[model samples]
Target: GGGWCSSDETCTYRLTNGLGSSKYYNETVFFGEIKSTNKTVNPDFYNWNRIVVEYCDSSSFMGKANHPKIISRGAQIFYAVMEELLEKGMASAKN
Candidate 1:
């Protein structure tokens, strides 16, 4: 996961990893544990569909950034994701 950055200097450093930008992201990721489909390992959620939000903003999905070179929009990403999920049936999800 991408760790948080508290200052411009640190956030600038984040550019070198997936935590800071998609340029460094992997094309695919492995999902395990609660995200697993193996009934033996995740009995209750074995059949559930899941989505993985990569930790990129480094703000714990709480804040935005004003740096000219850094694009930080954690809050916006969170709301947009929620909106899309709701529209796609999450609004009526039972679990």
Candidate 2:
């Protein structure tokens, strides 16, 4: 229900429920980074769950595989997280 955005474009966001306190809590974070260019266009996105998907293919977009390949671990991880979120009902916008 709460979040923060980075002021610098190169900086990444880290989520925490508490700040300026003596205690620290451990939790998983999603979409921790919002590139500077993206932030400039949608500052309000800081308030929402932000996912920065990376393309691991070494070649140009056209050279990329059309389907999920074994080497596409990044995509696999992303989908796994999405599935888990959906299963837990945490992916809902109402949350």
Question: Candidate 1 lDDT, tens digit per residue, 1-95?
Answer: 65689888999888887878789888998778888899998999999989878784888888776678877788999999999999999999995
Superposed model 1: Cα runs more than 4 Å off:
none
Clashes in model 2: which pairs? 31-50
> What's the TM-score of each model vs. the native?
0.88, 0.28
Task: State the displacement of the C-alpha of residue 27, model 2, in Å, after optimal TM-score superposition.
Answer: 17
- Segments in model 2 whose C-alpha atoms lie over 4 Å from true places: 1-43, 57-70, 73-75
Model 2 / residue 75 / CA error / Å: 5.4
Candidate 2 per-residue lDDT, tens place, 1-95, comes to 12222232211122122321113433544443453235655585656654532332222112222433212133555566678778876666584
Instruction: Report the number of the highest-lDDT candidate.
Output: 1
Cα lDDT, all candidates: 0.84, 0.38
Candidate 1 — what's its lDDT? 0.84
